[model samples]
Target: MNAASPKPVLEMRGIAKSFPGVKALEGVDLTLYPGQVTALIGENGAGKSTLVKILTGVYQPDGGTIVLDGTPVLFPTAEAAMDAGVSAIHQETVLFDELSVVENIFVGHQLTNRFGLLDWPAMRARTRAIMANIDPDIDPDTRLKDLGIARKHLVAIARALSVEATKIVIMDEPTAALSYKEVEDLYEIVERLKGQGKAILFISHKFEEIFRIADRYTVFRDGKPVGDGLVAEADTNKLISMMVGRTVEHIFPKIEVAPGGTVLEVQGLSHPTEFADISFSLRKGEILGFYGLVGAGRSEVMQALFGVTHPSAGTIRIEGKTIQPRTPIQAIDAGIVYVPEERGRQGAVTALPIFQNITLPSLARISRHGFLDLAKEFEITRHYAARLDLRASNLSQDVGTLSGGNQQKVVIGKWLATEPKVIILDEPTKGIDVGSKSAVHGFMSELASQGLSVIMVSSELPEILGMADRIVVMREGRIAGTFDRSAVDAEELVRHATGNTAKEAA
Candidate 1:
């Protein structure tokens, strides 16, 4: 526990917010101190973001008192929040794509010369200095569009650095697109920022990350603060349990099935730069779990299998029928569907309504002629929504506004609407709450019971162990080892995944 002696740098007391029908937050309290990172964690719709928005002036709280450095302040706009030395780096980087990194970083606070024109040299120097302060690897001249997602995110943080934000900095899911090396770099930056006595509010779903970086932690559930305090004394397992209000024994709910009838046979599957020589057979009523560390090509292999990426040298057969699917449509036509890991990007059209997102891939089947029949689409959406237990007040709500778990359900609903025999789920439960995770596990089990072949690729070892009848470990784009349900343990899985163990049949 923080001694609770001095007034904290920033404090929110009795914070509350609500929609017309949904209570987004209820009496949430948080305090941020200098020279420490406070991790804010919870299930989706747990009011973590709502609290952040209120702090950043994106959303006005229905009730609360915000005391910053012992002074009550009400931020009416994000700009006002920034002007008061509070800034947030969102999960998705918001920068002008056409602008160069230097220009983007110093946009609002650029150095101007006596002639009232942009000082290119001074701005570039300042950008380089800021990058050096954080990470010298990033180039200032590169256009924001040319940089990868992770780099763009760093650039957004650098924007905060340029302003010398002394009070608080909020980072939302900072490691989502970062490579392992980049994550390390970010940790270094975080350490440096902490030394400067900057109060950082870190938001992430990864327990390992939170454990490694956070000094204090807080949990929110159903838009209210459930737990709060220091991280050193908090148990990770207990924290997850408290966050979801349930004991989470296993994340993977794979059946112990005797695999039969080669449902999907991948022979010599190879994709340039992603993976190669991936050969495996997913049998009917079987859940084959692919486990690997981040960037070990798990999602890439799933994408290749779903025909999102063309295999350079491989033959995929569905029920012994040789199939060469050049596109996702071809894969769907062949009764094979892929529920992508990035639900927001590949799975759901955020702008579209729930019913539209569900029936998008299978609308032709429901339509009589070229003209569409929305009534039939609604029927299908209603059936799947009920079946998946999607928590939406109305079917007309935009899929983007739904919580992570519900959005994931929407993704599954879309693919289930296709009625595919073989379904590939890549990180199916990432960023979702425990309750929603249980729902997805049950749904997967039900799908397998219906004799649907499932191949789930996940980074979480528990999910793989819990759900997979057989686990396949991959390393550097090759099948490292295969383990039957009873044979594999977490250590062995890690060994195989990290290329420490040779190809062993278990």
Candidate 2:
């Protein structure tokens, strides 16, 4: 680590928090030093979110000491956290779409003149100054909706920096939506902030990102601090061990099952603005992996297949029978299911109980003559939850209260309960912990083994390589390349995904 500060900027000691059916955190401790980035490492349900929530003033700790500059403090509300200089930029940048960049930066706390009026010029200047530190090209007057995802993120960080007292910055999967070059820019911003002695709490599931940007590491497992050290002293294996409490021999445990006849075929699939000419086949007892970069239209293809969008022209064949799914009901009735990437938004109804979320699609089955069958709902939910080995306190637990992993399980079970012949998982393991990812992967294998045809759309090459029987690479909304497991490596996949030559990808 760089010459560390003698005193930590913030410290948490013996933090504890519990819920009705879960102990989210237990005696967890964390320390953040000025001028250093500390990686908060953990598996899903390991209390990382709870700790962040406490820090951000969204939740009060049941018991703990939050020390700031050698003084204990409490953030009873989100406003209090901002006033105390604790700011977070989430993976999904939460900003208004129609608002101007300057307005977003100075939304709640706009600069005022002596007359007590909003000082537009002053705010614009400050916005420009903040953008100068990140991107000089972003116009302060530009509407936020016009900028791309990466620029919106820059604005989110700028808004955080606008808080003059922001001493500690928390980045939760900030690079999840960023491209490679955008990620490089974020690293530079991080380094610049560190130079200014701003303590940073970096949370991420990608080990490569942690190794590249973090100086210190703290690992949490089962809601408790298990390890901490300089990142320089740790490797991928050691960190994995800390996160999961076991040697992670394999993240993608691909269980082989001989591929049978084609179960689903996509021929001449085309979307008006998303993807086009998508042709592929998923075999019975096979995992067909779709690999692509952001905006490569993998999810679009899946959405179209699931009847979320109408394909301008396409033919979908299930077991040699061609069908067009114009609505989600049609898709489900035709024995097709999709698990979306945005688990919090689209995959699961966070407000509903676990059993309700699982049995939602199968509601007709659980209901007779329009009367809901509560017991049958529980029975159906139990079967799939057990199949996925989901960890939760009870079937009545709200899906929102569960960790990322359990939430994902609830979504997957919701679809599987429909008894679909073909399942499309779009970024199935995104935003989940490593252990959760392994569980999802293993479950995918088990699904394939049981003759459930799977179309897994993932941006992760390692996952595609490990679990896919055949990989189809998409570039700019079309199939760029196709390869079997034995025929492709990381470089080749990158080449196809980016339309890059071998040397260019290197």
Candidate with maximal lDDT: 2
TM-score per prediction, in order, is 0.90, 0.93
Q: List where candidate 1 sits over 4 angstroms from the true fold.
A: 1-6, 111-115, 130-135, 495-506
What Cα-based lDDT does every candidate model obtain?
0.85, 0.90
RMSD of each: 3.2, 2.3
> Which ranges in model 2 have alpha carbons more than 4 Å from their true place?
3-5, 92-94, 97-100, 132-154, 502-506
Q: List the residue pairs that clash in candidate 1.
A: 252-463, 252-467, 253-467, 254-467
Question: Number of backbone collisions per candidate, in order?
Answer: 4, 0
